[model samples]
Target: MTITPAQVRSALLARREIAIIDVRDEAPFAAAHPLFAAQIPLARIAVEAPWRLPRKDVTIAVYDDGEGLAGQAVAQLRELGFTRVEELEGGLGGWRAAGYELFEDVNSYSKAFGELVEHRRGTPSLPAGDVQALIDEKADIAILDARRFEEYATMSIPTGRSVPGAELVLRAPVAAPDPDTTIIVNCAGRTRSIIGAQSLINAGLPNRVFALRNGTIGWTLAGQHLEHGRQESIEVGDGVDEARARAREVAYRAGVRRIDAGQLADLEAESHRTLYRFDVRQPDVYAAGHLSGFRNAPGGQLVQETDHFAPVRGARIVLADDLGPRADMTASWLAQLGWDVLVLEGGFDGDLATGSDGAPPPRGPEGRYKRPYEGTDNPAAAMQAYLDWEYGLVAQLERDGTHGFFVI
Candidate 1:
């Protein structure tokens, strides 16, 4: 079957259940995809699609940028038991030709919306050079690596502490006890950094806050040094514990549940029930060493994209995080979105496998992803033009009246 862009747009506008799959590589998909599309590269269809889109008969539409990949993907999906699979008419190029907005960057629309927030509200920011210099000087800066603990341990600015995304609100006061100290948040790329910084800002903190400019990718691109195997002691205080408890209550309000490791094991043992477990950390962290069966789905995008993360619509989901904030925060969003989401108990605290530390060495450069927004030879003008379009997205979100997003 073939689905037109207009029909897809209408389905999106009506809030219908349509899995708009972009069967392009990570790069182009990140460069641009339809506003509501989720990426499942054609190469990964046989392995990823069934788990991602578990409902065999759901309305699934696939697209590629005029390269005929979508047609190929539809055939593969059908063979894989996707009973209602269809290709997007004209593919991604057709959708673009229909004049619908295409979002860019990883979780592009959300990050673009965040940039728009910064543009409009002057969301605080710190330059990578300045933050790096402060770290070098050992100044009173609390560098919060907001991706996840494992991501922090994988490679981080020398002075960074692993503060996974959800824990910012709960751990902030303790991590930056000196009200005079500057607090900076970072992630592999942008979304978590923006959301983490804004989270602290919204909580009315006494300390100054800023997002690490462009996150870890920005730090790497700026020719900064990253440290690995540097472990720091973290102490959760009474105040922080109380804050975390309060955050849990907030999550309960949002519909999050807590389950122990044993229950998770029991659930995973059920062969008939499909369970999706996400470490809810950065990709680097997942590579470093995560729950044996869990995949990488960084907290911010996971919550922003519940449907893509757990396409079964009603599948049981277990999230793991050493720091509680991210799991609670993400589970809260999932519950509100009507998913059966729970945060797993117990943190992963073993040593590195490759190192004497007993932790497995992080997956190397081979595992690092090249974002779609970047181009090997694409001109500077196109990049700038792309940013200009992304810059106007928040206002468009308001006009379109979709997203169902509210600043927390």
Candidate 2:
């Protein structure tokens, strides 16, 4: 069976649960493809197909640019028990012939959505030089690093503390108790910094907040020094009550819903719809104990890397957490990003399962694309090109016109 480009475009506009996969390695797939296409090479179809597309009946369309791999992919997927599989009509050339736009780079749609959020909300930010001057003057500021603790330990701003993105809304009040203290959020690059700073703003925090523009890249370009091996962490204390209340309010405002165990079972029973159950908490805590059948995806990393976690654009996501604040805060962002997300309530009493940290196995080096935004050795030209691409995403998204994202 074959599906045309026009039919696929209509499905996307209708928000149908369809997976348009590019049957090629990351490097070539990143060079050019549809805005929402997920990369799963032909060779790894047997390994990745079952997990990535859990629902066997999901509409799956595989394509390649004149390479004879899509046929093999369809055969492999059928052998794996997929019920509805088809090849994309005309492949990459057909998409072009149908006058559809092709996007470049990995995680293109997620990056584009981030740009749209910034465009719609006008997220505030501060330059590296100005932030440095403030730190030098010993201003009343709390710098919260939104990257993972391991990434923060690698290199970070001089006075910044490790508070991952999902932790900001829950821990910001405790970290900067004084309403007068300025709160600054930073990540390795732009997207998380913008999202983190905006999260606090949306939560209605009283303190003045800003993102470190361009993050560590900006600091390095400005010739500023970054500290290593910082052990600072956000402490949970008497502020837990207030944090939970605030996070619940935010989730409500963002249109996130709550589901009981019975509803989750009903959701699982719908064979046509794909359902993903994730436990958003710290790795150590997840390893200690967790609810049955839920995989561990730390809340912060899940928001930062939504494309990797839920590649199907319109799947249903249910987040689980023993504590109220973490899952609520994470669900709020996911809802605003156009996902059908729910927070599972009251399910920690049964015999807890130990180890299912939802991280995917590492890909072989041959299939990976060397990202230009990572590492210190990237050329000035390449870095500038990456920033330029990000800056223009809002406009590109407008041209593409299938994203149903909104900022709350």
Candidate 3:
């Protein structure tokens, strides 16, 4: 069986449960792939397929760029008991030949959505040089690093604290109590920074908020020094109540729906609709105790890498967090990004499951893609190319015309 690009596009528009998978390695897949295509690399099919496409009969379409991997992938999937696997009619070349668009880089659609958000909202930002000047002058600005703690520890702006994206709305009050203090958000590159800064702004924080334009990349390009091994992090203390109220309000304004335990069960009962249940709390908290059948996907990273977590574009997502603020805030962004997202309401005390938090096992280094936005040594040309691609995303999305993303 072979599926055409037009059929795949129709499936996406209809919000059907179809997985258009690229069976090539990371590099080439990153170079170009359909907007909704997920990279499952043929080498890691056995490890990723079973969990990624959990339903045995879910529609699965595999494609490659004339590398002849799709046939093998379809055969392997069938052997693994997948009942609805097929090859892409034209492969990668075929999709291009059929006049379909191909997106670049990992998490392409999510990054493109971020670009759309910025374009639509005109999110405020400060260039790296201006931010550095404020730091030198000891200005009353709180620089929040929106990347993971590990990434922040590797290298961060001189005095930036590790607040990671989803935690921004919940911790911003605690980090910068003064309404007059300017808050600057930075990530390794653009998406998280744009989302984080916009998150605080959307939550209606009293402080002036701005994305550190181009994030750490811009800082590096500006020849500013970065701190290594920094341990600064936000502590949720006296402001928890306020944070919860603010976060819930933000979520409400973004059109997110709240579902109790019974409703969630009902959603689960709908076997025909693909549902992703995620505990959007920190890893340590999730590892300590999480709801049964829920996987640990920290909210910030979930928003940053939606394509990896929920490749089924139109699937329903339920976010769980013991503290309501995180889930509510995370769900707000997801809703704006066009996900059918719901926040699970109530205490976290049903059949609590604890341990590794249900994350899929990691693939070996051989299957991993070296991201151009990571590390300090990425070539200047590569970094510039990345920014160029991001700058063009809003236009690309306009041309694609299939993304249902809306800014609130």
Task: Report every candidate's CA lDDT.
Answer: 0.68, 0.86, 0.87
> Against the correct fold, how does model 1 do in TM-score?
0.69
- How would you encode candidate 1's per-residue C-alpha lDDT over 105-164 as one tens digit per residue? 555555655655566557788878999888778888898877656556767777788776
lDDT of 2 by residue, 70-155 (tens): 99999999999998999999999999898888888887876787677778898988999999999999999999998889989888
Error of 1 at 284 (Å): 13
Best-to-worst order by TM-score is 3, 2, 1
Candidate 2: lDDT of 372?
Answer: 69
What TM-score does structure 2 among the candidates reach? 0.95
Give me the overall lDDT of model 3: 0.87
Model 3 bad stretches (over 4 Å): none
Could you list the CA RMSD of all candidates, in the order they appear?
6.5, 1.7, 1.3
- lDDT, candidate 3, 38-125, per-residue tens: 9988888888887777677778889999988999999999999988888999798888998878899999988998898899899999
Worst 10 residues of 2 by lDDT: 354-363
The prediction achieving the highest lDDT against the true structure is 3
- Candidate 1 Cα outliers beyond 4 Å, as residue runs: 116-122, 129-139, 148-155, 216-240, 248-324, 331-369, 372-401
Who is ahead in TM-score, 1 or 2? 2
